[model samples]
Target: MNLSILYRGPLSSCNYACPYCPFAKRRETPAELAYDRRCLERFVSWVATRTGDSIGVLFTPWGEALIRKWYQSALVTLSSLPHVRKAAIQTNLSCQLDWVDACDKAKLALWCTFHPGETSRERFLAQCRVLLQRGVRFSVGVVGLKEHLAEIEALRRELPAEVYLWVNAYKRQREYYTPEMIADLTRIDPLFPLNNTFHASRGHSCRAGASVIAVDGEGTIRRCHFIPTPIGNIYDPNFADSLYERPCTNDTCGCHIGYVHLDRLKLYDTFGDGVLERIPYGFGESKPFLENLSHAHLSTE
Candidate 1:
């Protein structure tokens, strides 16, 4: 069976001092660098061993990963493989874009978040233009703070229509978004309503263990990012044992990567095979997503 791996190890170091994030404005040490390399090597080798199945990898780092040279090498190497359908990462768009030209355009993607104070909009848009010229798939996003309202609108205007722009709801102040505020953001991010809040998923069926998984630098496999308890190790001989149906221990699910896998949300069908590279959102002249919601509602009744 094909699988999606959310690799999130080698985390907690970042180049920008975003006030909201804990892992900000730090650099990796020599020891940290070595550890990251070794873990990636093991992961690459593990992928080589999985000849029977195709895999998609998303490097969900807490820090800025594109700044690291080894990550560039790994992404290049992974994208070249035939069995790897997708090898993408979440980045702050602070790194150079010339290196991205070497990776497989069809399989490589980026989930980029725009930090207002850390980098100017000009620099950010320049990198995005490079991706577009290279035919690389990516989605741009920002934390939906009221202060960023103008910047968000400007971003939508500058970016091409094919490139999807997303809005990340500020978790701390979600309750503060009045009907008017949500209406405003929804104009910027078509799927803002779904993304602006958490979904109650205590007993819903999900694709977490069956195919989607969150892996750490140490190869520890959790059902998904939200749950940190170890289900198994990827290197174990019988690591497949870890895959099973399990209920979410938490009541609410946020975060795009985590929230997308909730089966009850019907995102699995909405995104189809493009969930790793694209977000399913369209506010104007696009109502299929909303239509899907209604279809999903009738199916259960």
Candidate 2:
């Protein structure tokens, strides 16, 4: 079976202090960092044993992970595994880039996010250029805050046309984005409209527990991060038996990581093998895919 795992460890610390995030500027104690390291090592070891299944891993840490040496080492190690199809992470791109050269570029990808005020656009773009030079597959994105619209548009203009730039809508407040603002952002990212909607997902068929799972540092597994009920632990011998098609229990899912798995959305067709990295299939190709956006059936509760 081809299994996709979103692993989040206990390392909740970041270098930047973005106003919108709770974890902003939070630092972990030495003991806490050591605990996170141990958990990650155990998870990586567990992944190495899953030779019977084709595995893809995305490190969806609460804080920035790439800044830590352990995460970088883990990516390099995981990418080299023959059974691992892809090893990627959601990162702020604030770390050094030389380590990427040690990884198997074909199996390694990155989901890079740009914070407008936290990091200058030029610095982030330079990092992206290094990744491009290294032949790494990645997608760049920004949180769709109204204040950052100008920076977002400028980023789209400066980035290579082949690179896919995505936008995550700010949904903290109701009606956060005006229709005209949405339209402007949508023009830059055709997929922005989908991200802006709070998808009504309760009782909807989703691929979460079956083929895709959210795993924590302790190996506890759930349908996804938004759901708290644990189906099983990854360390359990019978864990594979617990995985099966399950409907979402939440009223709505706004996060891309959670909503993209809704079978009705058919996002797998939109993303193809790049689902974990958040890159659309046929991205950077002709604009024909934009015409089929309605087929995703985006809706809210």
lDDT string, candidate 1, 98-136, tens digits: 888789888988988899989989999998988888888
Worst 10 residues of 2 by lDDT: 286-295
Total colliding residue pairs, candidate 2: 0
Q: Model 1 RMSD to the real structure?
A: 2.7
Clashes per candidate, residues 3 or more apart or on different chains: 0, 0
Whole-model lDDT values for every prediction: 0.81, 0.92
CA shift at 15, candidate 2, in angstroms? 0.5
- Listed in order, each prediction's TM-score against the native is 0.93, 0.97
Lowest-scoring 10 consecutive residues by lDDT in candidate 1? Answer: 292-301
Instruction: State which candidate has the highest lDDT.
Output: 2
Candidate 1, superposed: residue stretches over 4 Å from native: 281-301
Give the per-residue lDDT digits (tens) of candidate 2, residues 275-301: 899988778774645644546776664
Give per-residue lDDT, candidate 1, residue 212.
Answer: 91
Q: What is the Cα-based lDDT of residue 117 in candidate 2?
A: 94
